[model samples]
Target: MSDLIHKDPTCFPVLEAAGLPSAFLDAIMDGVLCSAEAIMCIPQCLDALCLNNNGLQAVRDRNALRCFVKILTSRTYLRALTGETPGSLSTGLDELMRHASSLRGPGVDMVIEILNAILKIGSGVDASFSSSEPASCSTPLWKLMLTGAIR
Candidate 1:
């Protein structure tokens, strides 16, 4: 039984089709694997999109910022940040910060633009706000700061 399973190449199971070339079958399997990999890479792909100029523009846009603020205001935002949310959409934001240091050429420029956008967002807070208002220390921007993302 061990020989049949391990040493006997003739006994090994293989995908078979009537007229398909072996290479074609291999290509099909590769495509399936690659698709699965791409699905698993949603966070990285989203970060890539968000790091580009269009994404940066979207981030800097006032309307987009307003939408972002609304989402962050939710109680689940913290859980999402901590990667505690159930599902396939947990945070991979730390990857963006990690990439910030290793980027070059246009990548560096894009990162700078993103950081500038974030700084503008941070600076938008009024210095004269009432003390009765809740602190923003736990917000996503604050978490970015706490993580030394600026450095």
Candidate 2:
């Protein structure tokens, strides 16, 4: 979470930073905002935190990291990202996993599977994608688990 927040400000330090392209910043902003929305919707905040961490780890580029974090922590953006909600669990985590699994694409099913594993492990599990390929694959899935979109 700290990584995301700390890096977020760089998304747009100035209207014209010269080196920092507007298009790149825009893309990062979109990804960050999307991630935040996913986090808030999910019941498990901790899981969201974990996912942010995992995303941070997945990419080593400092600029990209900063953009992702900035979008996530932006209060104005976060509210819009979550949108209006009655605050109710319309679906279980398992169902979400099934849906994620059903999706066809590279990294799509993998993301869902990872989230399901995270829900099962909860915070008690301490692992990183660097530790193992299987573990790395699970990180994004865990983030999804936090969203409560998967069982």
Candidate 3:
């Protein structure tokens, strides 16, 4: 399975089409990270969107934050066939497989890693809040999303 993420062609899966591309998720995570704001409000943003259907935009006076927030708000937003939920192994693994099969866009990988350093992961106060992660990988979000269950 790690081979899939690392793209180890020697042991690549024989299955057909994977789920959402890693780069897309990475892009969203990267945007959230690079905007350089405190994540103390992410849980609030998430809750407001989920509870009130409030617009993701203007939640924190940033238009860029919407995409990142929307992607995080719903696991199945970009993924329909796979039904990828935020914090579950069955769904997240499927998301990983899908990510492995797809191609990635460039830039922002390092920024997300730095962003992860800024955020306090496993804070245990909220599920929507997440750790910063490398923009090239999908596992960080998946792991962060699943941490809610673990807590």
Candidate 4:
């Protein structure tokens, strides 16, 4: 069965299609990593989207985020994070953070990393509003970290 699955390369065309744009993929991956439910669907959706040539922009649509947030905010995602399943939102965030560290060139990865970090910290306070709050207020912290504003 394993060999049969491996022999038919089309069995996973999404991974191949995901080769589109690295920047877009990075953004979509970052969003999925931000939520637990979305993380569980990552492999399947990634495969399907890849087969259809759907790029990162397709995943960036407002409706997509709405749907992702709905699932993310649901009890299912929270339960999964609590150990009801193998995929946890924290794991996805960790993977994204690691990717952010290895990224080169422009500051997209840095911005995303900082944003995710702030969001994670805020999540502990209010999981609901954490997603809705403006990120601008968080900029000062980044400035402090980068410029040593406090020390």
Across residues 34-95, which tens digit of lDDT does each residue of candidate 3 receive?
22122222332222222211222222222223343434333233232122233342333234
Reference-based lDDT, residue 12, model 1: 25
What lDDT tens digits, residue by residue, belong to model 1 across residues 104-130? 244445445546644554564422211
Question: Model 1, 127: alpha-carbon shift in Å?
Answer: 12
Top of the candidates by TM-score: 4
Indicate the TM-score of model 3. 0.20
The segments of candidate 3 whose C-alpha lies over 4 angstroms from its true place after superposition are 1-66, 73-106, 109-121, 125-145
By TM-score, the candidates rank as: 4, 1, 2, 3
Which is superior by TM-score, 1 or 4? 4
TM-score, predicted candidate 2 vs. hidden true structure? 0.21
lDDT of each: 0.35, 0.34, 0.32, 0.38
* Pairs of colliding residues, candidate 1: none
- Model 1's C-alpha root-mean-square deviation from the true structure amounts to 15.5
Residue 7 Cα positional deviation in candidate 3, in Å, after optimal superposition: 32
Candidate 2, residue 77: Cα displacement in angstroms equals: 10
lDDT score, residue 130, model 3?
A: 45
lDDT tens per residue, model 4, 1-151: 1122235545434443444334334555445443444455443343333233232235433223233343343333433343433444434434433443322222254345546644554445434423432434433343233233334
